[model samples]
Target: MAVSMVGTNSLYTCLDMIDKMVSVNEGYIAKAILALLETEKCVVEGAGAVTLAAIMEGKLPELQGKR
Candidate 1:
C-alpha cells in the first residue's frame, strides 16, 4: 500500500481494479519485486509492480497465444 499525504483516490481505484480482476496482494507484489531485481536488475515499489506480478503469476493466460 502506498501512503501519500497528497491523496490516494487514483491509487485506490487502480488497487480496487486489481483486486477485482486478479486478486493481487502483498505476496504477489513481493514476488514481482524479487523477480524484477533478479531478471531486470531493477528496483520497483509494490504498486509499480502489480501488473508484472499478475503476468508472472500467469493471471493473463489469455494473452499467451496473442503474443
Candidate 2:
C-alpha cells in the first residue's frame, strides 16, 4: 500500500486548502486537492486523512510500498 498521491499529469497549482480540511466527529479528516494540469482544467482529489492521499505534500516516497 503506497502512502501518497500519485498522478501522471503535471499538476502545478497550489491554493489555500484550508476550507478543504474537514473534521468529523468520528475522528476522521478529509481534504480537497485542486490541481491545474498542463492540459488545463482542475482536478480534484478528495481522500481521507488516514489514506495516502492526505499525506501527499508534493513529495511522494516509497512508490513500491507504504511508509
Task: Provide C-alpha RMSD values for all models, in order.
Answer: 5.4, 15.8
Model 1's C-alpha root-mean-square deviation from the true structure amounts to 5.4
* Model 1: CA > 4 A from native: 1-20, 65-67
Given candidate 1, what's the lDDT at residue 62?
65
- TM-score of every prediction relative to native: 0.57, 0.19
> In candidate 2, what are the lDDT values of residues 1-67, reduced to their tens digit?
2436634343233333323432232222223233322223545334333333333442234443564
Under the 3 Å rule for N, CA and C atoms, how many clashes does model 1 have? Answer: 0
Residue pairs clashing, model 1: none
The models' CA-based lDDT, in order, is: 0.74, 0.34
Top candidate by TM-score: 1
Candidate 2 CA-lDDT value: 0.34
